[model samples]
Target chain A: MTPFDFFILSGLLFAVGLFGVIVRRNVISLFFSLELLLNSANVLLVAFSRLHGNLFGEVFVFFVLAVAAAEAAVGLAIVVALYRYRKSVNTEDFSTLRW
Target chain B: MREVFFYLFAFLSVVFAVVSVTHRNVIKGGLSLLASFVALGAVYFTAGAEFIGIVQVIVYGGAIVVLYLFTLMTMDLKNFGKEPLRTISLAAGGAISLFLLFSILYAGYRFYGGSIPATVSGAKELALPLFYRFLLPFEVVSVLLLVATVGAVAVGRREE
Candidate 1:
């Protein structure tokens, strides 16, 4: 398949992930959407690495994966902390700073 | 053929992602996300990124989803009340994403993704650049992971 195919896949996935982030109320779901966004970017990166006849893009993906894992770990910790404070995971409830 | 597998997994990835996002049950959503990741891994395989495909399945489908499920276990699920949908926000979100999708497609309409690879990339091929050329970034990422681990523990620990 062409690299265009990969880009189209990435774009659609990214759009869907962005929509989920905007509309979802749960913190966990927001994280899921975030993962989707990362995955979309990964797809495009790998395709392009192949496109240019280099492994650099693929190598970068390892960094992206590490970053994503770290983000998920820290983000989930924040969610748990927020949940302990508010007793709910809904974004509507965690608005103590919404002045 | 590679094209067939690529298209198939690509479609599956998109479908599963939507299902994961829209499902009311968080557990179901998480599982669907797992499916989507596996499909994406398959896409990488078909695209000739063999090592990336395997790593995607192991790290994303195995590690990350399990992390989510573990965090979910700590919270009581029954108490998560129904979130009422507002028509205005729904319309706005849909409109905005649709616009983005259209714009992205238009910008890349004439552009092709790139030519297909002559050789499939395996770990041996990938390891060369990762260890040599990107050694500094690799070390930095390791440090980032370590920091994130410590930070997560610090944030999540109960205060005495």
Candidate 2:
């Protein structure tokens, strides 16, 4: 496959993920969108790695994956705590920290 | 053959991603997100990053999506209710995403000019750099995972 094709696809995925993050109100859905965003970056990184004939980009993808996993773990825990406190996952209900 | 798979998976991923975002049911959205991730893994494989593709399937498809699903199981899905479907926010998001997509495509058109290099032996060749030159970062990622595990437990624990 062409690197350009990969990049274009990755860009579309990233854009869709971004739109989800912005428009979604449910916390769980937001998290899923975040994962899509991260995976899109992974796609680009691997494509670039192949394009440049270098392994650095792929190595970076590994690190990004690790960080994403950690972020998910922590983020879910926070969501659980929020659920317990407010009993809702809607972003609009998460106004306690706003003021 | 390769281009066909690429287009197929790319279409699958983008379509699923949009559905995942727009769907009101969180569990279904999460599942669709998983499908997108799997399609993305296939894209990586088609691009010749075999090891990364496998890892993508295992880690993202297997572990990460499972984590989200488990978290979803703990929540009351019935309480999700109807979303507001804000026109302004949707318009804003759509506009920004469209702008980004076009800009990226324009840049690619200008730079690549429809000529993309062929894929090399990424999986096999990545080994040396990963184990030798990038050994430190590799080990560091393990350490990071360990710390994340500990931190996640600490943060989630209920102290009475």
Candidate 3:
């Protein structure tokens, strides 16, 4: 497959994630979409790393993975805490201070 | 053979990503997301990034998804009622995403840069620069993970 093919794959994934972020109401599903976005970026990064003949992009993916793990942990923690207070995971229920 | 597998796994990843995001059930979405991640890992493998692919499966497919599942288990899924789809928002999302997809593809098509060499980079090849040049970032990521762990525990802790 060509590097351009890789771009297509990554772009489509990013679009799907973007659509999900805009459309999904559940907090968990939104998180799922966010992961999709990150994964897509990883895909493109790996592809470019391949194109450039270096390991830098692969190494960057490692950092991205690290950040994703941390984000998931903290984000889920916040989700659980929010659930405790709101009893709902819907985005609409999250508007406590809308002016 | 490599190209075939790449296309296959890439197609699977994208399909499963769509399914995972658009599924009506959150659990199903999560499961599909796991599948999508695995497929993406296979894509990486096809590209000869063995270490990153393995790490993808281990960390993303294994650790992160499980963490999400457990966290989800703690919540009352029955309480997360369905949200009605807004036509206007759906249209907007579709339009915006189409614009992004088209622009990205156009840019990629226009790219005439250098192609990748045949050499596949493994963990060993990656370690040299990672330890020497990128050492600070490596150390900082560990610290970031540590801080995140503590923050999660603190934030998710039940009040007395």
Best candidate per DockQ, number? 1
Q: lDDT of candidate 1 vs native?
A: 0.91
TM-score of chain B of each: 0.96, 0.90, 0.95
- Give a tens-digit lDDT track for model 1, residues B38-111: 99999999989999999999999999999999999999999999977888878887888888888777866665
Runs of candidate 1 exceeding 4 Å displacement: none
Interface RMSD in angstroms for candidate 2: 1.6
Model 3 C-alpha lDDT per residue in residues A1-99, reported as the tens digit of each score: 778888899999999999999998888999999999999899989988888777789889999999999999999999999999989999899887887
TM-score, predicted candidate 3 vs. hidden true structure = 0.97
* TM-scores for every predicted model: 0.97, 0.94, 0.97
**Model 1 chain A weakest lDDT span, ten residues long:** A1-10
lDDT (0 to 1) per candidate: 0.91, 0.83, 0.91
The fnat scores of all predictions, in order, read 0.78, 0.64, 0.79
TM-score: model 2 vs. ground truth: 0.94
Task: Please tell me the TM-score of chain B in candidate 2 relative to the true structure's chain B.
Answer: 0.90
Which regions of candidate 3 are displaced past 4 Å?
B112-116
Per-candidate interface DockQ score = 0.78, 0.69, 0.77
Candidate ranking (TM-score, best to worst): 1, 3, 2
Better of 2 and 3 by DockQ: 3
* Per-residue lDDT value at B7 in model 2: 88
Q: Which residue ranges in model 2 land beyond 4 Å of their true spot?
A: B114-124
